[model samples]
Target: MSNLQQQLNFVLEIDRLKAVYRQAMVKSDNNRFENSAEHSWHIALTAQILSPYAEDGVDLQRVTTMLLLHDIVEIDAGDTFAFADQTALDGQPEKELAAADRIFGLLPEQQFIEIKSLWLEFEAAQSIDAQYAKAIDRILPLLQNINNEGGSWVKHGVSKTQVIKRNQYLEKSAPKLWQFVLEQIELSVEKGWLKPE
Candidate 1:
């Protein structure tokens, strides 16, 4: 196929991401589950809007690109809940890598490598760009849970400690956002939406 054709095919294939639902409920959608596509779009905008708060300087464009591409693998590997136990997470990286290989392979070789690299960078979360991108990624779900009265946290019986432990790296990359998260956790606990322990 021509490169354009391959790119178009890749675009069409990724449309399926919209159908891959996640655990968080959308506050405006009458509590319907958010899809990975919606999450990706939200976090891309989140990264852009929150770029100034990154602890280290980052290329906002690169961070946005990483956020947009990071979850495309969920098209095939499926969304794993952040609070899922270890058993539910076993072999998840392998599954996502395989999904990346196949789904990203649909693009022309140059585009495939470039896009896959962004996804891998986000996964690694080592670069300043990746770190900020990851901080933004975690922010939305926490907001979603808080907006929905601890949407997933309450449903899963999640505790304040668990939420903090899951998301504490935000303190390193985005201290302001981390502080906001801490306050939200306390509010959730006070509202009885999250377990005190």
Candidate 2:
């Protein structure tokens, strides 16, 4: 096989990413929460739906691609929550970054660089796309928590205050979505997903 074909073959094998599927806090009606694949697709669709709400100009396509590819590292390194305490989230970038290099490097070099750049951009939240993508990244889990009665938040002992803090940036980038999230938080409490604190 040609070098190009080898890279293509590596990319085509979807089995590499499916070692385990994590439920998104709440079980879906199907008794399964969304997996990383569905999460990726959802964010891409979110970029399309929420582009107009982005506070700054964003390349929705780029944001979507970044969201779709960003979590592949989690396949190897496992996902650490964004609101995880400092130690859980910190001083461990090396492991995940190296994993990103390996998994993304499996693609052609240009794709590796571009995807890596997008992931970095999403992390830095420096660009409009990055910031908007970050909002989606944070917002989706909150939606799951609300829908599933605080699935992860309840499971992980997270407080409503913590959820609000993690969500505050949504107000800056996507006020409309942020408003919806706030309402959802209130409803989750009313629905007994969150015990009032």
CA lDDT, candidate 1, residue 48: 76
Clash count, candidate 1? 0
TM-score for each predicted model, relative to the true structure: 0.96, 0.84
* Poorest lDDT segment (10 consecutive residues) of candidate 1: 48-57
On residues 111-192, what C-alpha lDDT tens digit does candidate 2 reach at each position? 7788888888887777777777888987877777766657877777676677777777778778888898888878777776
The number of the candidate with the highest TM-score is 1
Candidate 1 structure quality by residue, lDDT tens digits, 1-197: 99999999999999999999999888897889999998999999988788778876778999888888899899889999998999999999999999999999999999999999888988998887888888888888888888787788889999999888877768888889898899999989999999999
Report, for all candidates in order, the number of backbone clashes. Answer: 0, 0
Tell me the TM-score of model 1: 0.96
By lDDT, the best candidate is: 1
**Superposed Cα deviation of residue 19, candidate 2 (Å):** 2.8
